[model samples]
Target: MTQQPIISLRDVGVRYKRAGSIFRKTQYYQALKSINLDIYPGETLGILGRNGAGKSTLLKVISGILKPDSGEIINRGASVSLLALQAGFDPNLSGRDNAVLSGMLQGYSRKEIESKLEEIQDFSELGDFFYEPVRTYSSGMRTRLGFSVSTTISPDVLLIDEVLSVGDKEFRKKAEQVIIQKIQSQQTIILVSHSEQQIIRLCERSIIL
Candidate 1:
Protein backbone atom coordinates (compact mmCIF):
# COMPACT_ATOMS: atom_id res chain seq x y z
CA MET A 1 0.00 0.00 0.00
CA THR A 2 1.17 3.53 -0.68
CA GLN A 3 2.08 5.75 2.23
CA GLN A 4 -0.04 8.75 3.04
CA PRO A 5 1.36 12.15 3.81
CA ILE A 6 1.55 13.24 7.43
CA ILE A 7 0.73 16.79 6.33
CA SER A 8 -0.88 18.07 3.15
CA LEU A 9 -1.34 21.50 1.62
CA ARG A 10 -4.00 21.98 -1.04
CA ASP A 11 -4.13 24.98 -3.33
CA VAL A 12 -2.59 27.10 -0.60
CA GLY A 13 -1.89 30.76 -1.16
CA VAL A 14 -0.62 33.54 1.09
CA ARG A 15 -1.06 37.19 0.29
CA TYR A 16 0.73 40.08 1.95
CA LYS A 17 -0.09 43.75 1.93
CA ARG A 18 2.80 46.13 1.42
CA ALA A 19 2.95 49.90 1.53
CA GLY A 20 3.72 51.86 -1.59
CA SER A 21 5.78 54.99 -1.98
CA ILE A 22 4.12 58.32 -1.28
CA PHE A 23 3.12 58.66 -4.92
CA ARG A 24 1.44 55.28 -5.32
CA LYS A 25 -1.35 53.19 -3.87
CA THR A 26 -0.66 50.23 -1.61
CA GLN A 27 -0.58 46.77 -3.17
CA TYR A 28 -0.83 43.14 -2.17
CA TYR A 29 1.58 40.45 -3.22
CA GLN A 30 1.32 36.71 -3.28
CA ALA A 31 4.01 35.06 -1.26
CA LEU A 32 2.80 31.59 -2.06
CA LYS A 33 0.35 30.86 -4.82
CA SER A 34 -1.64 27.71 -5.32
CA ILE A 35 0.93 25.64 -3.50
CA ASN A 36 0.23 21.95 -3.12
CA LEU A 37 2.60 19.82 -1.08
CA ASP A 38 2.53 16.50 0.68
CA ILE A 39 4.90 15.92 3.54
CA TYR A 40 5.35 12.24 4.22
CA PRO A 41 6.77 10.51 7.25
CA GLY A 42 10.51 9.95 7.64
CA GLU A 43 11.43 12.06 4.69
CA THR A 44 13.99 14.88 4.64
CA LEU A 45 12.50 17.51 2.38
CA GLY A 46 14.39 20.56 1.16
CA ILE A 47 13.09 23.95 0.07
CA LEU A 48 15.49 26.01 -1.96
CA GLY A 49 15.20 29.59 -3.10
CA ARG A 50 16.99 32.90 -3.17
CA ASN A 51 16.28 35.74 -0.76
CA GLY A 52 12.69 37.05 -0.73
CA ALA A 53 11.38 33.76 -2.11
CA GLY A 54 9.13 33.24 0.94
CA LYS A 55 11.22 30.40 2.32
CA SER A 56 10.68 31.43 5.94
CA THR A 57 7.06 32.18 5.18
CA LEU A 58 6.51 28.63 3.97
CA LEU A 59 8.04 27.22 7.11
CA LYS A 60 5.83 29.43 9.27
CA VAL A 61 2.76 28.25 7.36
CA ILE A 62 3.76 24.68 8.02
CA SER A 63 4.27 25.47 11.67
CA GLY A 64 0.82 27.12 11.78
CA ILE A 65 2.17 30.57 12.55
CA LEU A 66 0.80 31.96 9.32
CA LYS A 67 -2.65 31.25 7.97
CA PRO A 68 -2.95 31.05 4.22
CA ASP A 69 -5.24 33.47 2.44
CA SER A 70 -6.66 30.56 0.47
CA GLY A 71 -6.79 26.72 0.48
CA GLU A 72 -6.35 24.27 3.31
CA ILE A 73 -3.78 22.43 5.40
CA ILE A 74 -4.38 18.90 6.58
CA ASN A 75 -2.25 18.08 9.58
CA ARG A 76 -3.44 14.73 10.88
CA GLY A 77 -2.64 15.24 14.56
CA ALA A 78 1.06 15.28 13.92
CA SER A 79 3.10 17.96 15.70
CA VAL A 80 5.33 20.31 13.73
CA SER A 81 8.26 22.30 15.14
CA LEU A 82 9.98 25.22 13.53
CA LEU A 83 13.64 25.73 14.48
CA ALA A 84 13.46 29.32 15.60
CA LEU A 85 16.12 30.82 17.84
CA GLN A 86 14.32 33.72 19.43
CA ALA A 87 10.70 32.68 19.04
CA GLY A 88 8.55 32.14 22.09
CA PHE A 89 11.30 33.34 24.38
CA ASP A 90 10.93 36.09 26.91
CA PRO A 91 13.92 38.22 27.79
CA ASN A 92 12.95 38.25 31.45
CA LEU A 93 12.65 34.47 31.74
CA SER A 94 15.49 32.13 32.54
CA GLY A 95 16.73 29.76 29.86
CA ARG A 96 15.13 26.78 31.58
CA ASP A 97 11.76 28.49 31.85
CA ASN A 98 11.87 29.50 28.20
CA ALA A 99 12.65 25.96 27.21
CA VAL A 100 9.55 24.77 28.98
CA LEU A 101 7.45 27.43 27.27
CA SER A 102 8.91 26.58 23.88
CA GLY A 103 8.24 22.89 24.35
CA MET A 104 4.71 23.57 25.44
CA LEU A 105 4.23 25.55 22.26
CA GLN A 106 5.28 22.43 20.39
CA GLY A 107 2.24 20.61 21.87
CA TYR A 108 3.92 18.84 24.80
CA SER A 109 2.58 18.95 28.29
CA ARG A 110 4.53 20.82 30.97
CA LYS A 111 5.34 17.54 32.68
CA GLU A 112 6.60 16.01 29.48
CA ILE A 113 9.02 18.89 28.89
CA GLU A 114 10.14 19.13 32.50
CA SER A 115 11.12 15.47 32.35
CA LYS A 116 13.48 16.34 29.52
CA LEU A 117 14.78 19.53 31.15
CA GLU A 118 17.96 17.89 32.33
CA GLU A 119 18.69 16.60 28.86
CA ILE A 120 18.04 20.02 27.40
CA GLN A 121 20.38 21.61 29.88
CA ASP A 122 23.03 19.02 29.24
CA PHE A 123 22.84 19.30 25.46
CA SER A 124 23.07 23.07 25.69
CA GLU A 125 26.00 22.83 28.11
CA LEU A 126 24.85 26.09 29.67
CA GLY A 127 25.63 24.91 33.21
CA ASP A 128 24.76 27.66 35.69
CA PHE A 129 23.84 29.91 32.86
CA PHE A 130 20.72 27.88 32.21
CA TYR A 131 19.21 29.44 35.30
CA GLU A 132 20.10 32.93 34.24
CA PRO A 133 17.68 35.25 32.48
CA VAL A 134 17.82 35.29 28.71
CA ARG A 135 18.76 38.96 28.62
CA THR A 136 22.08 38.17 30.27
CA TYR A 137 23.06 35.59 27.69
CA SER A 138 25.43 36.17 24.84
CA SER A 139 24.38 35.41 21.28
CA GLY A 140 26.07 32.02 21.27
CA MET A 141 24.64 31.07 24.64
CA ARG A 142 21.14 31.96 23.47
CA THR A 143 21.55 30.02 20.28
CA ARG A 144 22.66 26.94 22.18
CA LEU A 145 19.68 27.15 24.49
CA GLY A 146 17.15 27.56 21.70
CA PHE A 147 18.70 24.83 19.57
CA SER A 148 18.76 22.41 22.48
CA VAL A 149 15.09 22.94 23.35
CA SER A 150 13.87 22.71 19.77
CA THR A 151 15.80 19.52 19.15
CA THR A 152 15.23 17.92 22.54
CA ILE A 153 11.47 18.39 22.69
CA SER A 154 11.28 16.08 19.70
CA PRO A 155 8.34 16.81 17.40
CA ASP A 156 7.03 14.54 14.65
CA VAL A 157 7.86 17.00 11.91
CA LEU A 158 10.97 19.21 12.29
CA LEU A 159 10.99 22.38 10.26
CA ILE A 160 14.41 24.02 9.94
CA ASP A 161 14.81 27.44 8.39
CA GLU A 162 18.53 28.01 7.71
CA VAL A 163 19.46 27.52 11.34
CA LEU A 164 21.91 24.65 10.89
CA SER A 165 24.79 27.09 10.64
CA VAL A 166 24.07 28.65 13.98
CA GLY A 167 26.22 29.12 17.12
CA ASP A 168 29.96 28.96 17.59
CA LYS A 169 32.20 26.56 15.71
CA GLU A 170 32.22 23.72 18.24
CA PHE A 171 28.51 23.97 18.92
CA ARG A 172 27.74 24.12 15.25
CA LYS A 173 29.57 20.82 14.79
CA LYS A 174 27.62 19.28 17.62
CA ALA A 175 24.33 20.62 16.24
CA GLU A 176 25.12 19.27 12.77
CA GLN A 177 25.87 15.83 14.19
CA VAL A 178 22.59 15.72 16.05
CA ILE A 179 20.66 16.72 12.93
CA ILE A 180 22.47 14.03 10.96
CA GLN A 181 21.49 11.48 13.56
CA LYS A 182 17.89 12.63 13.35
CA ILE A 183 17.88 12.16 9.60
CA GLN A 184 19.46 8.71 9.96
CA SER A 185 16.89 7.70 12.53
CA GLN A 186 14.03 8.35 10.08
CA GLN A 187 12.78 11.61 11.53
CA THR A 188 10.68 13.62 9.13
CA ILE A 189 12.27 16.99 8.41
CA ILE A 190 11.64 19.98 6.18
CA LEU A 191 14.70 22.19 5.70
CA VAL A 192 14.97 25.51 3.93
CA SER A 193 18.41 26.75 2.99
CA HIS A 194 20.31 28.66 0.35
CA SER A 195 23.08 26.10 0.38
CA GLU A 196 22.65 23.66 -2.46
CA GLN A 197 25.25 21.25 -1.10
CA GLN A 198 23.47 21.01 2.23
CA ILE A 199 20.16 20.28 0.54
CA ILE A 200 21.75 17.66 -1.68
CA ARG A 201 23.47 16.00 1.23
CA LEU A 202 20.60 15.90 3.72
CA CYS A 203 17.35 15.85 1.76
CA GLU A 204 15.76 12.89 0.00
CA ARG A 205 13.53 15.24 -1.97
CA SER A 206 13.66 18.96 -2.78
CA ILE A 207 11.51 21.73 -4.20
CA ILE A 208 12.56 25.10 -5.55
CA LEU A 209 10.43 28.18 -5.01
Candidate 2:
Protein backbone atom coordinates (compact mmCIF):
# COMPACT_ATOMS: atom_id res chain seq x y z
CA MET A 1 0.00 0.00 0.00
CA THR A 2 1.16 3.56 -0.70
CA GLN A 3 1.84 5.84 2.21
CA GLN A 4 -0.36 8.89 2.63
CA PRO A 5 1.04 12.27 1.80
CA ILE A 6 2.10 14.42 4.71
CA ILE A 7 1.71 17.60 2.62
CA SER A 8 -0.90 18.15 -0.06
CA LEU A 9 -1.32 21.16 -2.34
CA ARG A 10 -4.64 21.15 -4.22
CA ASP A 11 -5.08 23.54 -7.16
CA VAL A 12 -2.62 25.94 -5.56
CA GLY A 13 -2.02 29.30 -7.13
CA VAL A 14 0.29 32.11 -5.94
CA ARG A 15 0.07 35.57 -7.40
CA TYR A 16 2.27 38.60 -6.84
CA LYS A 17 1.55 42.21 -7.69
CA ARG A 18 4.12 43.77 -9.97
CA ALA A 19 5.70 47.16 -9.38
CA GLY A 20 3.83 49.48 -11.67
CA SER A 21 5.91 51.95 -13.63
CA ILE A 22 4.86 55.56 -13.94
CA PHE A 23 4.02 54.97 -17.57
CA ARG A 24 2.72 51.41 -17.35
CA LYS A 25 -0.26 49.83 -15.65
CA THR A 26 -0.10 47.72 -12.50
CA GLN A 27 -0.43 43.98 -12.93
CA TYR A 28 -0.71 40.80 -10.87
CA TYR A 29 2.03 38.35 -11.70
CA GLN A 30 1.22 34.69 -11.37
CA ALA A 31 3.96 32.93 -9.47
CA LEU A 32 2.61 29.40 -9.37
CA LYS A 33 0.08 28.59 -12.05
CA SER A 34 -2.58 26.20 -10.78
CA ILE A 35 0.03 23.84 -9.37
CA ASN A 36 -0.83 20.60 -7.63
CA LEU A 37 1.58 18.41 -5.71
CA ASP A 38 2.01 16.10 -2.75
CA ILE A 39 4.81 15.29 -0.38
CA TYR A 40 4.76 11.89 1.29
CA PRO A 41 6.19 10.82 4.59
CA GLY A 42 9.58 9.10 4.41
CA GLU A 43 10.25 10.60 1.02
CA THR A 44 12.59 13.30 -0.29
CA LEU A 45 10.90 15.58 -2.83
CA GLY A 46 13.34 17.41 -5.08
CA ILE A 47 12.22 20.61 -6.85
CA LEU A 48 13.99 21.92 -9.92
CA GLY A 49 13.36 24.98 -12.03
CA ARG A 50 15.03 27.87 -13.79
CA ASN A 51 15.23 31.26 -12.14
CA GLY A 52 11.80 32.75 -11.41
CA ALA A 53 10.16 29.32 -11.86
CA GLY A 54 8.35 29.60 -8.48
CA LYS A 55 10.53 27.04 -6.69
CA SER A 56 11.25 29.40 -3.81
CA THR A 57 7.65 30.59 -3.88
CA LEU A 58 6.47 27.00 -3.51
CA LEU A 59 8.75 26.50 -0.55
CA LYS A 60 7.55 29.71 1.07
CA VAL A 61 3.96 28.56 0.68
CA ILE A 62 4.58 25.20 2.29
CA SER A 63 6.72 26.68 5.04
CA GLY A 64 3.97 29.17 5.84
CA ILE A 65 6.10 32.14 4.87
CA LEU A 66 3.72 33.05 2.07
CA LYS A 67 0.00 32.51 1.76
CA PRO A 68 -1.38 31.29 -1.54
CA ASP A 69 -3.99 33.29 -3.37
CA SER A 70 -6.10 30.19 -3.96
CA GLY A 71 -6.40 26.51 -3.00
CA GLU A 72 -5.81 24.62 0.20
CA ILE A 73 -2.57 23.41 1.79
CA ILE A 74 -3.14 20.39 3.94
CA ASN A 75 -0.19 19.59 6.16
CA ARG A 76 -0.67 16.50 8.24
CA GLY A 77 1.38 15.17 11.12
CA ALA A 78 4.66 17.01 10.44
CA SER A 79 6.23 20.29 11.50
CA VAL A 80 7.95 22.21 8.71
CA SER A 81 11.36 23.97 8.73
CA LEU A 82 12.70 26.20 5.99
CA LEU A 83 16.25 26.36 4.59
CA ALA A 84 16.42 30.15 4.64
CA LEU A 85 18.01 30.45 8.04
CA GLN A 86 18.64 34.18 7.98
CA ALA A 87 15.14 35.07 6.94
CA GLY A 88 14.40 36.79 10.23
CA PHE A 89 17.82 37.25 11.78
CA ASP A 90 18.86 40.52 13.33
CA PRO A 91 22.14 41.85 12.05
CA ASN A 92 22.76 43.79 15.25
CA LEU A 93 22.57 40.68 17.38
CA SER A 94 25.49 38.41 18.20
CA GLY A 95 25.73 34.96 16.68
CA ARG A 96 24.96 33.38 20.05
CA ASP A 97 21.94 35.62 20.47
CA ASN A 98 20.72 34.81 16.99
CA ALA A 99 21.01 31.11 17.72
CA VAL A 100 18.67 31.39 20.66
CA LEU A 101 16.32 33.64 18.68
CA SER A 102 16.25 31.23 15.76
CA GLY A 103 15.60 28.33 18.12
CA MET A 104 12.57 30.11 19.50
CA LEU A 105 11.31 30.74 15.99
CA GLN A 106 11.63 27.02 15.31
CA GLY A 107 9.40 26.37 18.36
CA TYR A 108 12.12 25.48 20.85
CA SER A 109 12.15 26.96 24.31
CA ARG A 110 14.94 29.06 25.82
CA LYS A 111 16.05 26.12 27.97
CA GLU A 112 16.08 23.90 24.93
CA ILE A 113 18.20 26.39 23.03
CA GLU A 114 20.64 26.60 25.95
CA SER A 115 20.94 22.84 26.00
CA LYS A 116 21.98 22.73 22.34
CA LEU A 117 23.91 26.01 22.33
CA GLU A 118 27.30 24.35 22.60
CA GLU A 119 26.66 22.06 19.66
CA ILE A 120 25.53 24.95 17.49
CA GLN A 121 28.58 27.02 18.38
CA ASP A 122 30.97 24.14 17.75
CA PHE A 123 29.41 23.27 14.43
CA SER A 124 29.48 26.86 13.25
CA GLU A 125 33.19 27.21 14.08
CA LEU A 126 32.94 30.97 14.14
CA GLY A 127 35.46 31.07 17.01
CA ASP A 128 35.66 34.18 19.23
CA PHE A 129 33.61 35.95 16.64
CA PHE A 130 30.60 33.88 17.70
CA TYR A 131 30.05 36.39 20.44
CA GLU A 132 30.29 39.32 18.04
CA PRO A 133 27.56 41.01 16.08
CA VAL A 134 26.06 39.12 13.12
CA ARG A 135 26.87 42.06 10.87
CA THR A 136 30.56 41.33 11.41
CA TYR A 137 30.26 37.88 9.87
CA SER A 138 31.18 37.19 6.28
CA SER A 139 28.55 35.64 4.08
CA GLY A 140 30.14 32.22 4.42
CA MET A 141 30.39 32.56 8.18
CA ARG A 142 26.80 33.70 8.38
CA THR A 143 25.67 30.73 6.32
CA ARG A 144 27.60 28.33 8.53
CA LEU A 145 26.11 29.74 11.68
CA GLY A 146 22.63 29.90 10.21
CA PHE A 147 22.70 26.32 8.91
CA SER A 148 24.04 24.92 12.17
CA VAL A 149 21.51 26.69 14.38
CA SER A 150 18.55 26.00 12.09
CA THR A 151 19.16 22.28 11.58
CA THR A 152 20.10 21.60 15.19
CA ILE A 153 16.43 21.42 16.02
CA SER A 154 15.27 18.80 13.56
CA PRO A 155 11.79 18.99 12.07
CA ASP A 156 9.64 16.32 10.48
CA VAL A 157 9.57 18.30 7.26
CA LEU A 158 12.74 20.03 6.03
CA LEU A 159 12.66 22.59 3.21
CA ILE A 160 15.94 23.48 1.49
CA ASP A 161 15.86 26.40 -0.94
CA GLU A 162 19.11 26.31 -2.95
CA VAL A 163 21.08 27.54 0.05
CA LEU A 164 23.91 25.05 -0.28
CA SER A 165 25.77 27.54 -2.41
CA VAL A 166 26.14 29.83 0.59
CA GLY A 167 28.56 27.65 2.54
CA ASP A 168 32.00 26.16 2.13
CA LYS A 169 32.89 22.52 1.52
CA GLU A 170 33.20 21.55 5.18
CA PHE A 171 29.95 23.10 6.33
CA ARG A 172 28.16 21.73 3.29
CA LYS A 173 29.46 18.26 4.07
CA LYS A 174 28.20 18.48 7.63
CA ALA A 175 24.81 19.76 6.51
CA GLU A 176 24.53 17.04 3.88
CA GLN A 177 25.32 14.35 6.42
CA VAL A 178 22.70 15.65 8.81
CA ILE A 179 20.08 15.75 6.04
CA ILE A 180 21.06 12.27 4.80
CA GLN A 181 20.63 10.83 8.26
CA LYS A 182 17.24 12.50 8.55
CA ILE A 183 16.17 11.05 5.19
CA GLN A 184 17.23 7.55 6.25
CA SER A 185 15.20 7.97 9.41
CA GLN A 186 12.05 8.43 7.30
CA GLN A 187 11.58 12.16 7.68
CA THR A 188 9.91 14.15 4.91
CA ILE A 189 12.27 16.57 3.10
CA ILE A 190 11.61 19.02 0.29
CA LEU A 191 14.81 20.14 -1.42
CA VAL A 192 15.19 22.82 -4.10
CA SER A 193 18.49 22.54 -5.93
CA HIS A 194 19.96 23.31 -9.33
CA SER A 195 22.57 20.59 -8.98
CA GLU A 196 21.58 17.33 -10.64
CA GLN A 197 24.21 15.40 -8.71
CA GLN A 198 22.79 16.60 -5.43
CA ILE A 199 19.25 15.68 -6.51
CA ILE A 200 20.28 12.17 -7.58
CA ARG A 201 22.25 11.56 -4.44
CA LEU A 202 19.72 12.94 -1.98
CA CYS A 203 16.24 12.44 -3.44
CA GLU A 204 14.31 9.44 -4.79
CA ARG A 205 11.63 11.49 -6.54
CA SER A 206 11.82 14.92 -8.15
CA ILE A 207 9.31 17.42 -9.51
CA ILE A 208 10.34 19.77 -12.30
CA LEU A 209 8.66 23.14 -11.86
**Which is the leading candidate under lDDT?**
1
For residues 75-183, write the lDDT of model 1, one tens digit per residue: 9889888876656999899999999998887778999999999999999999999999999999899999989988874678999989899999999999989898888
Q: Tens digit of lDDT per residue, candidate 2, span 14-100? A: 999887889889899999987889898878889988899999999999988898999988988679888557646899999999999
Alpha carbon RMSD to native, model 2: 2.1
What's the lDDT for residue 107 in model 1? Answer: 70
lDDT of 2 at 32: 96
- Assess every candidate by TM-score: 0.90, 0.90
Candidate 1: worst-modelled 10 consecutive residues by lDDT = 78-87
Positional deviation of residue 199's Cα in model 1 after best superposition, in angstroms: 0.4
